[model samples]
Target chain A: MRNKWTKVLMSAMSASLLLTGASSAAMAKAKAAPQPVVLKVLYMSQQGYSTAVLNKMGAEFHKEHPNVTIEFTYLPYPQLHSAILTSAAAPVAQYDVVLSDLIWTGEFAAKGYTVALNNYIRQYIKNPKGIPQSVWNGLSVGGKVMAMPFLANFQNFYYNKKMLAEAGFKSGPKTMAQWLHQMQVLKAKHIVQYPYEDSWLQAEGLVCDYVRTAGEFGNGNLFNAKGQPIMNQGAALKALEWMRMLYKDGLANPNSLAADEPTAANAFASGQAAFNTNWTFVTGIMNNKSESKIVGQGVVSGFPVAPGTNRATLSASISGFQGLAIAANTPASLKPWAWKWIQFATSPAVQAQHLHSEWPIWSSVATSPQEKHLNPWYKVYQQNLNAVYNRPAVSNYLTVSSIIQQYVHEAIGGTIPVKTAANDMVQQIESLPK
Target chain B: MTSMPVESPPKRATLRHRLFRTLSGEYFWLYLLLLPSLLILVAVILIPMLFAFQMSLGNTSIVVLGGRGTISNQWVGLQNYLSLLQNPSFWQALRETLYFWVVSIFIEVTVGIGMAVLMNQSFFGRRIFRVIVFIPWAIPTVVNAMLWGMIFDGDNFGALNDLLLQWHVIQSPIVWLNPSALFPQIPWLSNALSYLGSNLAMNSIIVGDEWKTLPIVAILVLAGLQTIPHEYYEAARVEGASAWRQFRQITLPLIAPVLTVVLILRTMQLMRAFTLIFTLEQFGLPVLSIQAYQQAFSFGSFGMGSAVSFLIGLIALVIAYFYIKRLYREEL
Candidate 1:
């Protein structure tokens, strides 16, 4: 009877141990469950990925992370900068993630508005695999990764092949002189009254166009290694004078002085102009039946070189790429999830899926045969990316850009001389608050 | 009990009676009734104006102020004002604002008076005409600006351009939104015209502003016109006074008070006019309000923006003071 009692006691003890172990394992899993988080994100409504694509991606992200939710707010491109600045001034961040323009990376980072992603990149990204060095250079400020490369864009040269053929040209012009000659013929023949449509308005569009032209006509960089303005002389001066000549000689549209990018795109898409330079997004607009009159006749090519200039390896388009960044004031608990959202959004697979809307930041996806097949402009975009005139990464870049815009616009408007405009631009930029 | 109550009531002043006596004093209840509004005015208007003045004396950004940091650290007394005085953009913007004010006020008063007189007549479909005149005023400023922007667009798709083309007014489209392009290319005339601040762009803005602003002035003037008895016109008609003479002597003098008030009010509104110009021309027109907007919002320089704001407020106040003084003097 005693032996039977011992066996029962031992069996009971073993059963209790097994029960405790099972319960502990279950409790640990419950503890490890992710906390629910709602991340507020801000993005530009125009250009880059559409809201629908981003929403679809958000839904997919929620599928993997059932505990996380993404809330989005869209503003126009100009308002996005102000909104981000205004919101970041708050103690608790209003947005957890923001889409930052490449031009704003320096300013945003310097203001401590965005969190550095170096640690997150090291932990999650491991290898940036296909992102180009130039892209990283744009997203980094003071050797700190302020954002993740999200979209790659540049000023793309778009032409009407049918118009050029009618003007007795087989292919697009390889140099500015050749393009000018072709425009003259097109104008003389009355095929198109204004052969070149440019965004030379008194805004950022003017600066972007001027940068590309200066790169093609002037020296390689507007600022030197010491980060000083050198646009007062050399290729920059010539580029400004050439732009004035285009407008004065009646080769460029008279409305070019008042036109922005969309206006230029409209003029090109409606078969009103034979040659135009605009963002890569214009390709979609030019080919879209609803938005274009000469849909299939539009051709995409790298920016042309100035006459007597040999830049075989590098092209002279402005780097108009953008990035995804985490706000600095995001709560510590929500930061990890913010990084996850950025990672998923910028992943090569996701970017490749939406390749038709925007160019992938990954060099591999950009050059992949599948992506190339999907976007024929990818080939030309790759060539344009070879050497782009990156607006110098300065904290005061907006002020600098504004000064350039005003002077260049004055020159184009015939309110000031080209040399005086160039000299005044340098003077004003140098005088900006440090 | 009656004798005791009469004796006791003679000696004491009760708190309720004393309070009632105080309340019955001159304008006490009037001020007491206005307490809520006064509090609101102090909160919304007085506090912000004072704070803006404080900021105007400093060199700070919205970030610093928004973060609740001590602005004294960034203080540079009167430097913002001094710098603004030296800034060429500020002078240009001031010139544009003056031009806009002079043109808009003149047009608003003249057109408003004309509309008021016409509407005062016993015409058929008068009610419908009044509503049609008010439709532009009822439309939101943003929507109106956008509508006008589309009409003034320098594209082939623009309404004005398309209409002009269809009507055979011109063989080629004119770039209406650009001042330099819209003006004739004659050297002497262009230079003279530039000095006068009479660009097509500003004139286009005035046209849009007048469409929306005329009704308010007209309604005010109409109310004033109604106050003048029909007997006055009948008396004048009984005399040898002509129609033009009667209008000049009777209508002009009678509506003068309302017109002065409307002009002063419109001056304040026009000096702060930003949405119309900003929406239409963007950075193209650097008027005072746009300058303030750019400094505060675009450049994030709150100090400079506040200085610009204070200057605008001071100008409006000075003009109001002069007009009000004249009004009181005329009354006396």
Candidate 2:
């Protein structure tokens, strides 16, 4: 009886050990698969500031994802246009990701180089609340989304608080006439320092600003509502005339024609100009003691409204989260990994942390009171984001923008008459392949 | 074979043995000396050249192919070439190129000779001036272009406008970049005499290029000056020759070869004058290289681009050939 009991007990013990081993194996199978990824990113950070923020983010990202390595490359602001296009065209996946000015989405997307993130967006981010819907508009074409917005950038008028006050105004001019009256008042009073200054050079920034303002005044689309050319209309010519008046009256700095985006920002912060139009990042840059002469002295507001228009037109530029696109040709195996990394990087928690360092595309991150409380600048940025107008998302957008810039520059310089410049745009756009 | 060569077992070895031995040695030595270099040259240059040539000839882009009018679908033969030939823009670019080259070369060659001659003379600051003259060349082309661009900026921020106003040369500032301003855009190379022409004048004006590129010519002239013995100068001076006379006679004659060398080099390189023109475009001067670049890279019309490129090469060769026939006739 003792030997029989001993054999039975031994069998029971062995069975228990074998059962434990089987259960452990099942648990291991249920655990998540380790997705190995090397995410390569290409972006431009303002030489010092953005780079610092990116480095900090990289460290955090690495800590969170020890298996995934990050490769980041920075380009100068001016060359971003050429660099992004060339990289996208090259055979090697020069960068697994890309960041650029907003206008590039149409060109990059149409080329089918950007990876479609629609499935990923629906799956990973069900309700990215704080980001603007306008951000999504730039990423989609013909029902397919080519990229995801990394951040928000909407145009705002940057005015010198002190200069405006001295010019007998407490805040920015609400309307175009009011602004022109202010310029005249300042000029007559000799309170004007740099004249009625705004950068209207032949570039996307100026063209967008002008187009938006014209749209504000009910000038049909700068390219017409049907996406056909109509820039030769009266409203556009009037706008051109108004700009010319600034130069003609010597109200604007003579160097205004050659100035690019940052140069305009520099001029405004230096108190060399009374008012200028710019975007949200100006707040962070101007607040720095070393860079600005008017720290805490500049105020952000909506751009001046056109006469007879109920609202001011708002335009978007890329200074923050640019749309993320994955190449169509990327391997199916890499697709899931790419989607996951994009989801993680653009997550609300991550975006909120990196807020204003890059423009946040997540509505939740952009509008979070928590975010506004920290930066304060996002309040103005978010307001502008609410009314943002993106450029026509078409493949030939780059060609179109170049044409506009050239014609605009010619008109402003008086080299080509305003009417002629406007007409030229119509002719050129019509001549281009539909 | 052994029996045929066995004539008292020749110390130097039979002809067959010698030929085989030499062939084997040559194989190792030749390959050892040239293999790596050949491999690298093929990898870097020859292959790329062949690829580019094939692309230029084919109907389709090797890299980015697709579309009804794509590289392959459209059997447009040299229709792309024919179109480029007829393009007004192409002609405009060619015209601008000629204007840029002729003006830049004229100023650079003349000023370079002057500087070289002066450097050859005894002076207090000769070394300093020579070094200073070389400074622009030492600086990158973009930097040099920037420096000159700064000088011509008609805007208040321009150093040139400031200087001119300070000297009371003008009461009001000029719009060197604007074609419409009363201070009309200066055509520095063609229409303007360098002084009246504004910064745009550099496209027409020699200053845009003359000072920037003069160093290359100066160095070449200096080499020629060195080769001409001091005896020639001594003889001219002994005859109580005027400075101008000596310059025309001994100096010009001996320096002609170096002058031709610099001239040939400049002609070859003149087709690719993008840095200065590209820089100036920021201020709004459209030159040929930039226009062509825009057509190709910006517009993505590889056929038109290749045609433009081929034309540029053709013109440069023609110019070079003319110079070669005139100056390098006997020696070459």
Candidate 3:
């Protein structure tokens, strides 16, 4: 009787072990299967670029992962940053994927609003090498990638080809003096009312123009290694003085002081200005027949260097790249899907298709022969991207940029002399808490 | 008297019973009627003011949809205010604010009064003229600013520049919005006008704001003008009073109340002028409102911004106090 009881107990133990193992296997399979997810993407509302292209990419992403649905919220550039911050501060995550300005990387990372993308890149991204190291660096903070750089833009020199040719120039100016001479010729010949127009309004646009112009004269960096203001240096002063001269000499459009990017672009596209300096997107705008009176008449060239300086030393233009990142508040379950969307949006195929309007951050997409064939301006854009100047990556970049904007605007407005403005800027920046 | 006091000594009302009685009495409905508005005032105005005051006392640096969005209260009591006191930008903004307030209020009152007097006359198109005068006030302030921005645009395509060029008003197109261009160096009055001229950006903004607000002021003044009996004017006319004398003696005194109210209200509006100037010139002309906004939003210095805002509020309060005292004296 004792032997029979022992055998029965052994049989019961074996049955219980089998039951537990089977249940564990079923649970693992359930967890591995893709669950339904809805992701919200925040992006700028740029015409034909952000809204259209992002929606297309979302649809494609939906096709790949049928369980996932994408909901996009398009905001104006001025409102996008504020909206993202508001959503991040909410108790629950509002956005899964965010399209962020390069200037915002440090601030966002410091606030813990963005998750580190390095692990995702290593695990999910098949061709991380397709993105340039410089771009990756721009999107990274403290050895961790904060976002995936997708759109690359920089300031480029744009001029009316007809006006230049009419002024007896086969190519655009290569030096500051040559550029000034061409402006004079354009003014003298009545090819345009003003030699050039710019988005010099006392805003972020002014900072962009200032940095690009200063890079041609200065060390191509606004701050020193210690994060102290170096804009009062000789080269930067010369750049400010040059801009003042443009205003004083009636070479720059009088309205340029009040004009934002749209106004400047409109003035150029309306054939009211012979030359304009703007981002890469303006090239597509100027070339489009529907929106441009100067269609097929505009040409893109590298930003002019100082009179005798080599291109290597003074060829820098301000980079205005926008990238995508997963929100820090995003649930762990939703992170994989968010990263998947980012990858799909920034993939080579989509980038090549929108190459004419939206600049590519990927080296492969940027240099793709098919893309080059589709958009003739790709070569010039790539050339401009080669020597891009990034703004300071400090967490307080917005504040720093505002200070630069104020002093530089006062200088341009003649409220104070350029020297005084530069001194004031340095003093104010020095007074900022370390 | 002793016997009556003995009977009257029946217990005085309890505190709770008296409070309940007051609440349930004739004033109860009146209090109920005011409860919603009182709640709104506390929620919208009082709460925010208290919160801002609290923020001002701390080293709060919250830049709402940008920056770090973290609130750090290091308890730097009065440091922000002291720092602002020593800062040149703060003084400059204050100076600009005073200049804007004085100039905009003066122009608005003058134009508003002139329009009011003219519209008071029984003319053939008086109704049509009144409608025309109020059109500017009907337009949104931002829309008005944008419209004026386009008109005063410094480009050759600007309507004003184009018209002036066509009329040969000057040799070349003048940069209407350029602060430096507005005031050329005059040998005699350079010292006085130079500073003012360098701030033409502020003046241009003032022009835009006045265009939007003048109509409202005129309408208010006109309503006050209508309240005055024509018999007073008739009596003065029979007594051989000149139009100027009649206006100085009767019209001015009678309309002083309306004008005082207008001054107080307009002063408050101009003291906190942000949207029009922000939309027009941005930080081109730094007034207190713009300075506060820049401190809070652009620089993320919430404590400093709150201090700046309180300073502006204090100034407005002091000015309003004087105006109200003057109004009360006039009423007496």
On a 0 to 1 TM-score scale, where does candidate 2 land against the true structure? 0.83
For candidate 3 chain A, which ten residues in a row score worst on lDDT? Answer: A307-316
lDDT digits (tens) for residues B197-258 of candidate 1:
66777887898889888998898999899999999999998997998999899999888889
* All-Cα superposition RMSD per candidate: 5.8, 7.2, 6.3
At residue A262, what lDDT does model 2 achieve? 67
Tell me the spans in candidate 3 whose CA falls farther than 4 Å from its real position: A1-41, A48-74, A85-89, A93-97, A188-190, A307-314, A329-337, B1-14, B63-70, B187-198, B330-332
Error of 1 at B262 (Å): 2.8
User: DockQ for all models, in order?
Assistant: 0.28, 0.16, 0.25
Measured against the true structure, the TM-scores of the candidates, in listed sequence, are: 0.90, 0.83, 0.88
Q: Judging by TM-score against the true structure, name the best candidate.
A: 1
Tell me the whole-model lDDT of each prediction, alpha carbons only: 0.83, 0.66, 0.81
Q: Rank the candidates by DockQ, best first.
A: 1, 3, 2
* RMSD of model 3 against the true structure: 6.3
Residue A277 lDDT in candidate 2: 70
lDDT of candidate model 1 versus the reference = 0.83
Candidate 3 structure quality by residue, lDDT tens digits, A385-411: 876777778887888888988888779
Pick by DockQ: 1 or 2, better one: 1
Q: Work out how many backbone clashes candidate 1 has.
A: 1
Tens digits of per-residue lDDT, candidate 2, B158-229, equal 677778889999875654544333334444342343223233544423566666678878877887887889
* Model 1 per-residue lDDT tens digits across residues A273-378: 9999998888899889999999899999977787665456445788887889988777778888999999999998898888878888888888888887988777
